[model samples]
Each structure stands twice: as C-alpha cells, then as structure tokens.
Target chain A: MKTLNENAQSVGTILLEIGALLMSSGASTNRTRITMERIARGLGYGIELLITQRALMLTIIEKDQQHFFSRLKRISPHGANFRIVSGISHLSWNVMEQDWTIAQISEEVQRLKALPHYPRLVVLGMVGLAGAGFCRIFGGGYIEMTVAFVATVAGLFVRQEATKAKFNPYLCIFFAAFAASLIAGTAEYLKIGTEPDKALATSVLFLVPGIPLINSVTDLMDGNIQNGMVRAMNGLMIAFSIAMGLLSVKMILNF
Target chain B: MIFLEIITKSFWAGIAAMGFAVLFNVPRRAILSIGMLGAVGGLIKFTVMNFDIGIIFASFLGATAIGIISIQMAHMRNSPPLVFSIPSVIPMVPGMFAYKMMLGLIALTSIENTDDYLQSLISTVNNGAKAMFILISLGTGVAIPMLLSRKESIKKSKFNKKKEVTV
Candidate 1:
C-alpha cells in the first residue's frame, strides 16, 4: 500500500509537469483538463483536478486518505508545438490502454519532453514559403511573392534569434514585424511588384496569433472563462505589438 | 477565369497552411490533411464573398467548414480537433484589417486639420470594428461544431464508459 501511494504521487507530479508544459506551449484549457483527467484515470485513481492559466492542482482520495498535490508554474508565452501536445495525448491514451507501470510512463514522458525540434534553418525556410503563399493567395504576382518570401525569411530569422536570446515575446514579434515590413516595403519603392500592397500585407502574416485566438474561443465556449480571457488578452497584445512594429516601418518609409 | 482564380487561390492557401503546420511542429502524417482543410475553408470563404456576402459572414462560413472538417480529421488521425483546426485557419486571419486599423490610429495624431483627423478616426474605428467582428465570427464558427460534437465523442470513448462503471 505504501508503495502504491508513492507511485501515485510520482504519477501526480508527472501529470502536473505535463500540464504545465502543455499550457505554456499554447494548448487550450480544455485540452489541459482532458489530458490530466485521462492520466489520473489510467493510474487508477479517483482524482479531482483544478486548472487555471498559471497553475494546476490535483487531489486523489484513496481509502479515505486524501493526497493533494499542487504546482504553481507560470505558463510562459511561446509558439505552439502540436507535436509535443499530440505526443503527450498519445502517451496518456496508451497508459489507459496498456495499464503501463509508473516507471514506463515516466520514461515516456521524459522522452517526449526531450524530443528535438526541427532545425532553425528549415523553420525559417517554411515561414518564408508560407509568406510567399499568402502573397499569392491575396492576388500577388510573382514579383510580389518573391519579395514577400525574402522578407519573411529575414524577419523570421530575427524572431528566431530573439527567441533564442530569451527576449520578451512581444519584443520578438515587434522586431520581426519591423524587419519584415521594411523589406517588403521595397516593392513599393522599387515598383517591382504588380501588387505592392499585397506583398506588404502578406509579409507580416506569419506573426498573427491565429492559434491563441482560436484556443481562446474554444476555452470560452467550453466554460473555461477565466483562461479564455487570459488567452484572449495575450493574443490581443501580440497583435498590438505586430501592428506597432509594422506602423513604425510604414512611418519611416513614408508609405 | 473565375474558376481558375479560385483553384489557384485555394492551392496557395493550402500551401500556406502546410507551411504553418510545419512551424507548429505538427506530426508528419497530419500535414497533408491540415493543408486540405485550409484549402477547403479558404475556398468556401472566397466563394461566399463572391456572392456579395460581407466578409464577416464569409469568414463565419469558412471557419464553420474548417471546424467541421477538423473534427472529422481528428477522428481519422486519432488526435484532437485543434491539431487540425488551428493551423488550417491561419490563412483567413484578418491581418490586413488589423494592420490598417493600427495605421489609421497612428496616422490620426499627425493630421493638423480637424476634418482630416476626424476622417482618420472614422476609418480607424471602422477597420477596428471589422477586425474584431471577423475574429469573433471565426471563433464562434469554430466553436459551434466542436460544441455540437463533444457529447458524441464523450459517449463513444471507452474511457468514459469505464468512468461510468467505476462510479
């Protein structure tokens, strides 16, 4: 019985860590709750979970002995990585299906945590291509698309470097937008693109907080109002920062 | 010509969404599905707009399509709906409207004439409201399908059955 109690506590701690990572990585409140509940159920515990934007609390009652574990980990704002979220989701489902021992679950969680991200250059290339694609969708010709592609590559490089240096997220976005717009605005000055306006607009589309905005609505609809509001505010702030960055470039270029 | 334009635009939107999926580090197998969802959503929005529907309504319809398709993809991929929904909708974000609103706000302070200032103010308000409405519509549209399907998912999952038995 003592051994079981210890195992349960370790599982609780692992769940909390996973919860914190998911929230910080931009998972919706609903996802956080569902994942935690599944892990607790898989561990064969009757658990109560309390979740907020900043903290997670889990309580388990076994044989009238209540075990409570709470962790206060501030969710740092970061880009969404669905790979990690999906990995954790699969892990919990496997736990329930396989009835895995505590040690196996912990090892799996650690492996997911340590999964290496894609190389920086590849990410930069994709961002550039995405920007170019946005330009084309908005009716830009080849010249505008090329300009957008180059500008996005440069801009995302700046953003990546800022992120690596641990700069504030808003600051990182601001710098990226500033860099992207400055480059894109050259289309207007040089009269190279048939649709300079489209080039300028699409170059900065990479900075939009589409995921957070969507997640906020999901949370609000699911009755997690507090978390929804917090996420909504964060999304708005990022949008505001991007606007500021772009406006500065526009002001300087007099475009 | 119009049909060709739609096809080209949808293709670009799909490509853009796939790029975004990569940035989000979506699992390799799911990228194509996400791209297809984005293409369909973008196509729907564009087609709706061609009928003279306002952008807000068009965005709503597009997001609803995305939400529905994402739910289906989630079932097929064995992952959450959000894994498909969020990146797919990236192409439709009202980024231009938001930027224009901010531009108008900044430009407001520089105008010396009262009439010009009022003009900028009106434009700013108009653009700002449009952006806000579009965002709300996107959110509401995505939420509707998810909300409707939640009960079905809960009832079908084996874990929930076990949960009931234990209780």
Candidate 2:
C-alpha cells in the first residue's frame, strides 16, 4: 500500500492546487456559479449536486461552512488566483480538522465528481423575464414590477454556476447590456406606459450600488480606516464597470 | 415621437439602473424587483402629473412608496432594510440635474459667454442644490419607516420584559 499512499498524496496535492485556482476565480464581483461547479468537479462531485450543496451551505451560519460556499461563489471570472488558493486552504483546514486521511479526502473528491448536473439556472432566468413581461401586460403597477424584477435578479444571483463560463470581460459586459436591452425593449414594445424615460430608468435600477455602499459605509462607520477606504475604492470600480456597460450601450443608441 | 422618446429613454434608464445594481453586488433578485418597481413608479408618477398634482408631491409619494416596498423586501429577504431600499429608488433619481450642472460648469470654463455666464451658473447651482435636497428628503422619508419599526421593536421588548418580571 505504499503505492496507494503515494497515489493519495498525489491526489491531495492536485486537489489543493485546483482549490487555489478556484479561490482566485471566486473573487469576481458577480457570477461565481461556474468556478464553484468546477471546484466541485475537481473534488470528484457532480456539478448539479455541488450547486445544490453550495446553496444549502450559503444558508448555513457557521463561518467554516459559509466560507466554503463563498469561495465557490467566487468562481466568477473576475476572481483572482490568490482567492481560490485561499479557499482551498480553508477547505484543507476543514479536512484536517475532520482527521480524514489523505486517501479518504481524495476519495471524497472522486465521489463528488461522478454526480449529474442540470442547467436549471439559465432556464430560471428566461422564465423570470417572461413572467415580468406577463406582469407588465396585466396592468401590474410598481409592486408587480418590483416583484418580477427582484425575482429575476434573485434567480440569476442564485445561479452562481454561470460564473465559470469562459472568463471574458467584454463578453460579461455584453451580457449585462443584453439583459438591460431585453428588459427595456420588452417594456417599450409593450407600451408599458407613455413615460419611456421613467420606465427605462426603472428597468436599470437593478444595477445600482449596493454591497460596496454597505461595506464602505460600515467600514467607515466602524473606524476601520484602511479597510473602509479600500472597500469604497472597490465599490467605485464596480460602479465604473456598470457605467461602462450602460454608457457603451447609450453611445451605440446615441443616448 | 413621444412614444419613441419614451421607449428610448426607458431603455437607457433600465440600463443605468441594472448596471448600478450589479455593480453594488445587491442580490440579483432584489435588483430585478427594484428596477422594475422603480421604472413603474417613474412612469406612473409622470403620467399622474396630468391630473395637476405638484411634481414634488408626486415625486415624494412615488419615492415613499418605493421605500416602503423596499422595506418589505428587506423583511422578506432577512437582509438590512436599506439593502433593497437604496437600489429600488435609484431609477427616479435626478441624474439629469447633476449632468446639467456639470455641463454648465464645463461651458463656463471652456468659453466666454460673458453676459449669460453668471446667470446660467447661478441657475445650474440652484438646480443641483434643489436636486440634492430632493434626494435628502427622499432618504429621510425612507429612514422614518425603518426608524419607526425599530421604535416599535423596542417597545415590544420592554413589554416582554415587564411580563417576564410579573410572571
């Protein structure tokens, strides 16, 4: 079993490296769904099962449990390599704490890899958009609109599995713009109302400053001098990206 | 022509709102709901003005409704109240006012419209200030509901304590 021992050791090292890559990928601002799935695959689990597990993990309160899934969530294209490595380290610690043998851990990874995955996330997005359109038709006012929009956004946010798609910034921006255009185009086509300006403004409201605002405000309030400033800067970058997406479209449309 | 303008304008507005929400890392669901709500609110308010209600009152009421909606969202999501409220109300924000002020500043610095400059500058600043006040009032209005809810919670907690002592 010296051979078995060596094989287990090799698997552990490889898994750890993969985990590191995942952590870096996880740092992306949005859509970490793909990276997490890959990480689950690397650990030897099916993609779909991993996503469900990750979702449940998010609903957990313990730092360790939540941290594992958060790292998976970071699979968005914007994630840095270091972040994935950090996440792998976090998971490794969990393994170590559990007193599992290297072979056992490797076996666990292998087991996870064999599960089947379904692409419900994308379907959810399409369905949600369609539902919003329907709501608009029924003369649904602000409340219905808000519910539909929020539900659509929440559905996308939850999918996080899409984050692992080939990491291309230009493509990401395009998708962002495309989503906005669809929302705007649908509402406009339906003649949701005569006030197109207001409707357009409302449709895009989903992209406003949120986490950064909260993080920056909290850090600043708590007197975490350096941390607060850094968070604020990060928040600004996110806003900049959003502006880039909108402005690009606006220029194309001559707005 | 007005119909075309409405569509184009709403499209841009949607892009702006969606972009901002994504940037902020607000949950996608919350963003979608707020975006749609804000758009509807903007449309409804604009339409209602034909009935002769003052613009300020209309704006305040619309914004307040959004605030209340967001608060309900926060409760449903188990997130902080502002998480949903802040982003939800953004579509109705006076971005044009801010844009105009900047444009006026640029014009003053770039050329000599000597006769018209002071008056325009003053007007630009006045408009910007007014917009800022509107935002402040909206923010205050949003906070009042949250604050009142907190006060209610405090009273409930105190009442529970008294009951505990008596028991």
Candidate 3:
C-alpha cells in the first residue's frame, strides 16, 4: 500500500493529466473543474481547482494535510472528441458512485486517453457530405451541391494533411478555405453550377467555429468571464483567418 | 410549396448535423439523436422565418430548441450536453454572413472613388453587424437552457451543496 503522500501525488498527477486532456479537447472551464473535483472527491479528498487558458492549479486536502499540485499546460485547442470527453466523464462518475480503487481509475483514464479518433478519410468524407448538405439547404442546385461536395473534400484533405504536418491551426484553416474556394471558383468559371455563389459559401462551412462560439458563451454565462473572452477571441481570430483565406481566392479570380 | 421547402431544408440540416457529429467524433450511438435535434431546430427556424420574423429571431428560436433538446438528451444518454448541442448547432451557423462581410471589406479596399468606398464600407458594416448579432443570439439562446440545467444539477448534487456551504 502506498503512503498517503504517495497516493496524493499519484492522484494529483492523474487529475492534472485529465484536466489537460479536457482543456486541450475544448471543454469549458466549468466542465474541467467539475470533472476534476468529482475525481478528487471519489478519492476521499476535497480539492480546490483553478483553471485558466494557460495553467491549472489544484489543491487537495486529505486527513488535515494539504497537497498542492500546479501544472503548466498550454492550451492548444484542437478537434473535439466527445467520445473521450464522455468516456472520462462516465469514468469519473463511476469512480464517484462506485467503490473503485485508485489504480483502477488511473488505468481507465489511461485507456480513455489512448482512444483513437476516427480515420482521416472518414472525417473528410463526412465533412464533404456536410458541405453538400449545407449547399442544398441554402438552395443550391444539384450541380452546385456536387461541386460543393468535391470542393469540401479537397479542402478537408488539405486540412488533414496540414494538421498531420503539425501546422498552426490558423494556417491550416486558411489553406483549407483557400483550396475549397479555389475549387468552387473554378466550378463557377466553368458554369458547372447555377448557384456557384451558394456552393462557394457552403463549401467552407466546415471552418465555422460553431462549437467554440457556443462554448465561449456557455463559459461566460457560467461566470468564467476571462476564459470566455479568451475563447471568444480565439474563435473570432479563426473566423478571420477563414475569411482571409476565402477572400484571397476571390481576389485572384477577380470574382 | 413553403412547407415543402421547410421540410427539405430541415432534412438537409439533419444530414449536415450528422456529418458534423461524425466530424467532431461524437459517440456513434448519439449521432442519430443529435441529427434529430438539428432537424427540429432547423424546422423551427425555417417555420418562424416563413412568418416574416427576422433571421436573428429565427436563429434564436432554433438554437433554443436545440439547447432544450440537448439538455434532455444529456440526461437520457448520461453524457455531457455539449456532446449533442455543439454539432446540432453547427447547421445554423451564419457562415454566409461572415463571407459577405469579408467580401464587403475586400470591395471597400479595392474601390478607388470615395462614393464607392463608402458604399462598400456601409455594406461591410451591415454584414458584420448582422453576423455579430446572429452569433450573439445563437450564444444566448443556447446558454439559457444550459445555464438552467446546470443550476438544477448543482442543486441535486449533494457534494456540490456541501462544497458551497464550506466555501
């Protein structure tokens, strides 16, 4: 059996890892805090956690002894994987509700952290379908829908490649939008679609910061004003990058 | 014809939402429900717009519908509300307005005559404001239901209650 301090150190490390995963995965501050608290509570200790866009501070008090763990984790916002999030969530809930040992919980966390995301080709296909769907909803003709689908697939492929190359997210989005808009513009120039404008617009819909914007507002509403502002600004910057990318293609085409 | 348009739009919106669900890597089991939520939200927005309501108001109602449904889905599925809500809301994002705003800005810069510049500037501002307002409304609409549900959860959790008392 580990000593109390040893157990505390291990728990703190696991909690910090979980918190970093949550933050990097685009979870709001409240979700991160609540989940960490739940895990600490499950370990028969109470914790005070402070989370920001840059770092996490956790203080756990057990048996009248105070243990402080501070982790410096830069939040590099990335794709959302609800599977890992909900998996960790369920694990924490189970820990709180069941009689699970510390080792078991840690093992589960590791397993969840290692869960693989969907393949790149699958994601690309879905995003292309989504673009086509948006085009149709926005009143694009069948031809325009087809063009949008092809454009979005090409764009998302570029995005995936850029991401795998570890390019900055803004640059990735910019290139992706550039590629998509270029294809859509070519389609328009060829008169392949009656609603080329609609196709062009919808083909880049995948870049919209829908989840981040909502998360920002939810954070603000929940009273994490500073983090909310940071997230909102980040989302706005991404939107600007996407616009810049699309505009570059339009300028080149003089359309 | 109008009703048919709404149906088609909603159907497409559902497909879009499902695609987003897959993009976000939401759990396979929750994809269908998220798609249904997006469809309901899109239907509400389309129907309300047919009544001549402004797009902002239409987006608000649609997002609210999504928010409420997401909360219910979260409870039923034992998952976080964000899992369902985020993808469902993607179908209603104002991507076109943002694009138009950028176009206006580009036009504003390229124009030589003052009159043309001012015209482009006005259009730019209009599109930007509309986009911002729509985004704000979407945020507020989703936040309301989420905030309410969060409060209820806090009240129900005894650990949180004790923590509150201590703090």
Candidate 4:
C-alpha cells in the first residue's frame, strides 16, 4: 500500500505540473484538459482535471478506474506564451508516437521553461512601430504617427520597469497607459500633428488585452464558461484601468 | 493609387501583427508567416470595406480567411492554429469603438438637457453595439475552422471505415 501510494504521488506531481504550465501559458481550457489527459494516458494512468483561473484540481486514477491521488496546484499569473503551448502540444504527440518515458517528458518541459524570450529592446521597438501603425490606420498624419511611436516606446518601458519592480499587474497597466497618453496628449496640446486625436487613441493600443478577450470568447464557446467569464472580467478590468489612466491624463492636461 | 493605399495599409498591418506575435512569444519559425497572414487578412477587409460591405461583415470575412489560412498553416508549421489566428486578427480588433462607447457613456451620465442626453445615448449605443457585433463575428469566424474540424477527426474516419468493412 505504501509503495502504491508513493508511485501515484510521484507521477501525479508531474501531471499536475504540466497541466498548470499549459494553463498559465494561454492554452484554451479545452486544450489544457485534453493535453493533460493525453500525457496521463501515455504514462498508463487516467486523469480528471478541473481548471480555473486561479488553480487547477487534478485526480490521478489507475487505468482500471481506481482512484489513486488527488492534488490541487495554484497557477501563477497568466501570461500569453504561444511557444510554450506549441511545445507542449508537440510533446503530447511525441508521447503518443515515440512513447516517451516520464523522465524524457519532464526534461523537455524544463527545456521549454527555459526557452529565451526575444530581447527586450526588439519587442519594445517592434511594438512601438505597431503603435504607429495603429495611428496610420486611424488616419493620423505622419507627425501623429511619430508621436504615437515615441509615446508607445515610453509607455512600454514604464510598464516593464513597473512590472519588474513587482507592482500589481493592473497598476502596471495603468501607469503604462498614463505615460503613453500623457505624451500623446502633450503632442495634441501643442498642435504638433494633424489628427492628434487618432494619435491619442492609438498610443495605448499596445495594452488592450486582445489575447485575453479572444481567449475568453473561445473558452465560452468551448463550454468552459467559468474560465471564460474570469478571463472576460480580467480583460474588462484591464480596459477599465486603461480608461482611468487616459482620463487622468485628460484631467491633468485639461485638454 | 487605390492599390498603393491598400498595399501601404496592409504592410503596416503585417508589421503590427508581427509585433503582437513577438509579444505573445510565438515560435521563431512562425513569426514570418504570422506577419504575411496578418497582411492578407487586412487586405481582404480593406478591399471588402471599400465596396461598402460594412465593418462588421468585413471583419467576419477577414477573420474567416485568417481562420482557414491559420488552420492550413498550423498543419505545416506544427503549431496550434490559434497561435497564428489570435495575433493576426488582433490588428483588426475594434478597440477605438469601445473607447468611444466608454466616453459616450460618461457624457450621457452628465448631460444637462434631454436633447444632449438622447444624443449621447444614441452614439454610445451605436458604438457599443458595433463593437459587440464585430467582436462576435470575429470570434465566430475564427472558430469556424476548429469547430468544423470536429467532424473530420482521424478516429471518426477510421471508425466509419471499420463499420463499412464489417458490412
């Protein structure tokens, strides 16, 4: 009985760990459940997983349906990391096709966890250009686009610095939005651009929580109503944070 | 001249999509494809909207093309389709509409007269509903391929063949 319990506990830890990784990396709830299940089946066990925005509850059972272990893992804050999601999906196929051992799978997970993100400078510059694109698409003139580009780079820098300082995520968003809007608003005040309103609108477009909004709707359609509602609420809260930031800038500049 | 306009607009849209792809930390190999698909999606929407087809329908058409193309790309790229579709469609997201709706609602709340109140309400509702419907269309458009794939699983096909063989 002791050996059986120990064995179940060891495998169950990895299963729950992988599930939490997938969930936090922006796998849709349905895909999270499916991937966890596939990995468990490959290891000759069965699983029942319950995913929530804050935590994941898992049950590991014998192949013949005898319950063995139940565990709950608190997920870290969610971030959109598509590369991790794809890596785990590919890992699942290998588990089935190549019949990987638990040891091999865990090593791969570690490797995935260590995959280097693009340099911070590249992301900031590219996203700044994206802000300029938003301005152009909104019919801003070249000057407005230039203002937006500068504002976005500044805003994103503030956001990263705040996040690094360990502020609340929503507060980071608020500060970023405020910084972006203030620059764009100052440009508007100076009459530096044609259609500065478009610049103001597009300057903070980088922080719109687009991924969460789309994932929320996708989750709802997949019948993961609870996770869907949580994600939608998160998106709304971020949107509201952005609005408050912009409103504060408007009040300060009194434009 | 119109072609030039479309080309420039789409080029920027692709850049925006690639920007988002980096933010999402998509795989390195998929980034270029994500950019090209983003441009194509934007091109279709702009071309369709030029004909007065309307923003909502244009978004649906653009998103559907993204959906179809993302799925085809997924098989070749070995990544989930959503990894491509989500960031690509984001360049088309109607964020400004929502911003307008919020401001309009604030205006409606403080109006001094009934006429102003009605005007505020009209614009607020108009922008809000437009944003809502466009979002729904984009969601449905993107989901169509994944949902449709439900009936095309290999296991289902294999099961049918086995039944036919037995018969």
- A150-199: candidate 4 lDDT, tens digit per residue: 99999999999999999999999999999999999999999887788889
TM-scores across all candidates? 0.91, 0.39, 0.92, 0.93
Please, what are the lDDT tens digits per residue for candidate 3 over residues B39-80?
Answer: 999999999999999999999999988877776677666677
DockQ numbers for every candidate? 0.49, 0.06, 0.47, 0.42
Best by TM-score: 4
For model 3, the stretches where C-alpha displacement exceeds 4 angstroms are A1-6, A63-67, B149-167
Model 2, stretches more than 4 Å misplaced?
A1-255, B1-23, B28-36, B47-57, B150-167
TM-score (chain B) for candidate 2 is 0.67
Interface RMSD of each: 3.7, 11.4, 4.1, 5.0
Sorted on lDDT, best first, the list reads 4, 3, 1, 2
**Deviation of model 2 at B133, angstroms:** 1.5
Candidate 1 local lDDT, A15-102, one digit each (tens): 7788887887768887788777777777776667778877777666554456555444455556788888878877877777777667
**In model 3 chain A, which range of ten residues has the least summed lDDT?**
A67-76
- lDDT at B82 for candidate 2? 48
Worst 10 residues of 3 chain B by lDDT: B158-167
Deviation of model 2 at A188, angstroms: 20
Q: List the residue pairs that clash in candidate 1.
A: none
Q: Write the per-residue lDDT of candidate 2 for residues B1-167, one digit (tens) a residue.
A: 65544444344344444444443344444556656655655555454544687555555666666666665554454333444555445555544344345445555675667668888889779756755455544544444553455542211332132321210
Better of 1 and 2 by DockQ: 1
**What's the distance in Å from true for residue B121, model 3?**
2.1
Q: CAPRI verdict on model 3?
A: acceptable
Q: How large a fraction of the reference contact set does each model reproduce?
A: 0.66, 0.01, 0.66, 0.53
